[model samples]
Target: MFCLLLSVMRRIICSLATQLVALIVVIINWYQWDKEVEGYIEHKAVLCEFMSSALHEAPASYDDIKGKYVFGRTTRPQFFSMLHRYNVIQAYTQKKEFVWIGISARPWFIGFAVLQFGYVSVFCIQLYNTVTRESWKAKTTVPLFGWLFGGKWVSNVHGSVGPTAEGHSVDFSAPFTGQSAKIRFVGGGLEFDVSGTVKKVEGLPSRKPTLAARYELSGSAQLPKEFLGLVFPLGPRRAAVVHKFSAVPLSRPLSVGIGEGVWHGMGHISMDYTRGLLRRDTRWCWCTATAPEGYGFHLSAGTYDIGGKSMENSFYANGKVALLNTAVGFRKVFEKMVKAEEENIDISSGDTLRWAVTGDGIDLQFACVDSHNGTVHCGVVDGNLNHSWGIFNGTITVNGIVYEFSDVPGALEQHNMRW
Candidate 1:
């Protein structure tokens, strides 16, 4: 009885604290600065109009000054150069090499990283089998991240298969220095490679043109340092410049063997390279889905700066890209069991996880067959990443056209980090 009472009291305190924070944010952004948020929805609609035009314009590169937000589906070398020029010892930055390659109609995801913050240099590699729900991850940290000496850059990302109580493992390494449109990951049991070419837009094209092996995306967004810290009292502001590229439904033949299973099929590859001056504590939610006939969407929410003018939400179908201008919301339908002994729940049995991603013209439901949870505690750096893989079902109404989807292969993720 006493423990139950304590839990109730804790719940009350948490609820009150949440309400207080919401009140403060509303007062700061909406009431105090009335002009900024007047007709909020209508304002967002106008911004979306402007965004659509800008995407159509599709500037080749960002201006060197850096403050304005930009969007597009092509790579900008100037953005990469700008990130490398800014030096903030307290800030963290990374160039992530990520790929989601489909084999034999099955999905496999890979992640490799070269990151630096202060004097800490971190490298990471993650592999996931979406259908089987098996994952392998490894990371390492060193004192000195890298160096640029006499116009030459030098560093390396190195990792090995170590002792694991269960599941699979692999050893991998790649050069961390410089940028490359072509990337290769060589390891003890895996060989994967991707060749990328820039898709250039000569003029203001009505629709984005496809490339043989399109390999880059450029975007920028402003976000607050802490979760739900849109108001100044919570945390300072931060910015991120990102590059993404995709080659969906690759026509070329690809085959791979993992464990005792072998997969063979035409594959798909997607990659993201990000650089940010982020906060010490941050949290975000992200989801991605790839459907047949060149349809896919990327949805992300959490960590918006004051005014919330910049958003990262877009979907592409049949080679035409459209922006989702409204805010996105996420609700977890399958709750994680907190007290196993009392609840009599077996987490290993793999219950179907569900999440509803909804917005003005978007409604996406992701149902997971299996999930992978990872937690790392390396002193000051503590992180939790939960990933669930399954299918998506729902409808999105865009420009008066209702797009219906059923049983689309996708993944949902919840990530929290403190560094």
Candidate 2:
């Protein structure tokens, strides 16, 4: 009993210490915004920034940037608050803030996406918030007999709060510059406490991190509450400032607990952190995958092409990230008023999903094993979202190292929104 009490007290102290450190990091980032902007400008002007081994930081403001460019690797989100009003190129109707994390653990896959939109006009300011979570546990059995009596399970949880005057309630770290990202969300019977970390590969160029950046974290998640199947439906554009890090394998395995079942194993994690003034209507289709041997890739169309030199399409291998400089295409995808072209990938039409994605150095096929989908139409905001998980069979050659993988876990997503 005494030991248990001491352990609880130790956890409390650790929690408090973590929060205090996060708060301090936020404060320091807020004060040193200018220095971040300088680094962004300096790197943007260099033609070799994409191949530079030096670590870079996200700029505090896009006010001074002339054109769009890609970073060598995923950088911090220090300057995601707002675009400079005067240098506005795109007529953004609303401010959209989004963060998504996808995890792939063998026989079980989990994903979460949180989005907040603030529609500001001369008369009134409105806010719309939505959180979506999905988890799947694959069925296992004796070959033929298992196929006869199969029981595969999946859970979808969704929450769409109203057009309230209240401010944003989710507390997300601004800089997002750490080795591990902590994810904690609790509401209406759904709870999550997950941490994702990435260690720099040996022999890679050293990075110049910003002031007081910590690169280590540990975390866990428990989903004891029942899943709420509520649904509602819910985009804009200025420069469409976006930063995505894909196929980042966790240095440590992530353990997940769902009700009666507990899963503890190694898995790859990806992040999508973006903030910008945006167009009233937007659409996109995306796919990502991770192999057990630390291999991953990301592909998309109708998005991440916001008139910039950089794109969010790349593959991961040898503990390094290589950018893809080619056009991507999607097929059998829906678009309300916008037309979509399929250049690199083709999606088949049927009950099951199949994807044939090919590029300059990538040739891969994805077949769906299970899927989850939801739609929302609440008068002013509406959207269609489809998320699927399956196996990846193909090869990606980067830097002469051929990563030939088969039967690896991956996902495909398509979304169209009007807000």
Candidate 3:
């Protein structure tokens, strides 16, 4: 019927241009003229009141330059243990990709990402609220990928006002170039626009809800950009400014309609473009998955301008990449991961928390199951992060075979933006 009347006039002109940009973002969030989003929403509402005073006790007294609405000139405490370089000749590159349209027996988990830096271009819509362990994100930044030293011609609209996400209550991160990271084309990609809601906070414990789902993910990816890639740099100026990853999935499953739910599984995507210069007070541990000889792994025990070349311990399987030379003590493997919740003495609430890592030959085992710790305002000063969604049990011998895993699906992280 004439293409269903041009898809209902393009969904009524994109819902009246998203209700006129949500009525001009409720009048610029009531005139808070963007001081890097009023110092990241007053440093994430003082880290959400220090994460609700961490469920009971802790986190009082914090004043390093008036709680970060924008800070620098960290009063050189003797050059703060020397080491601060990320120039890579005026670098500031970026490139991205993310794909996880899952199905481990149905019940949905969708994520489609994209990004291109310098004169901006971003999109991220991640949803994995399969009834708890909450997550429903959204992001958008425009300028449509301009180039040549990439700057100027910008636009923004950040998210999370619901879906149990009590962070980013309208920030514009003004005066620009504040890349606290936080993807491309294929078989027809790039289309998203969904807006908020996921209440439950009046008195907590409704599985602790208070998130907003303001997603606007777009897409595109169909191979060839070297089929599966990498481009190293983790030192000097721009201390690790280029990480190109390409996940090639989706040969079978596909069914969509998120919000009032309807999503199946089996999907993988990728896009990565990065331009350097970022390193100031660090602590990192980045895990990636969807395996079979390799499609992820990035560990860090330290990186202050990747000085001695741990280059973020690399390993990307099946298509190849093996960069590793040092840095993997993860602070003595986090003392064997804080003894994994005291050896999971019968972990309740949809349980799953087991940890292991062994020998100079690696004998790993990780089964997370669920985790979503938060405390935003990243890039330092009380910026915690623990976003885990599990499944990684047994074997990993690589060229020596042994590669085994039953529950498969993966993603595990541990972050502390210099806490």
Q: How many Å off is the CA of 232 in candidate 1? A: 18
lDDT of 3 by residue, 1-419 (tens): 99999999999999999999997886555322211121221344433442242212111111224431111111000110111222222222322212222222223344433333433444333455434544444444554342332222121223211111122111122224332122212133322223333232222111233544322222222332222112222221112223334334544554444345555445454333223233334455554444533255444454422333344455445545555444454211223325543522222233345555333334556665544554446342356655555555655454554556555555555666532
TM-scores for every predicted model:
0.53, 0.52, 0.25
- Encode model 1's per-residue lDDT on 110-159: one tens digit a residue: 44444445445444433445555454433444444432211111122322
Weakest lDDT window of 10 consecutive positions for candidate 3: 73-82
Cα-based lDDT for every prediction: 0.43, 0.44, 0.37
- Runs of candidate 2 with Cα error greater than 4 angstroms are 1-58, 63-93, 119-237, 306-310, 332-350, 376-383
lDDT of 2 by residue, 1-419 (tens): 99999999999999999999998887666433322221222333342543453223433323236433323333232332334442211222254555555666565445555444433111000000111122222211122221122211111232211111012123222222221123433331112243322221121112111222112222233221111110000111123545455555554566554333345666566555455554456677788877767667777776635233226677665445676776665444323322345432222222334667766677777766444444558766687666666667888887777888677766777778886
Runs of candidate 3 with Cα error greater than 4 angstroms are: 1-109, 112-116, 124-237, 241-259, 262-275, 278-287, 290-404, 411-419
Error of 3 at 230 (Å): 19
Candidate 2, residue 193: CA error in Å? 0.7
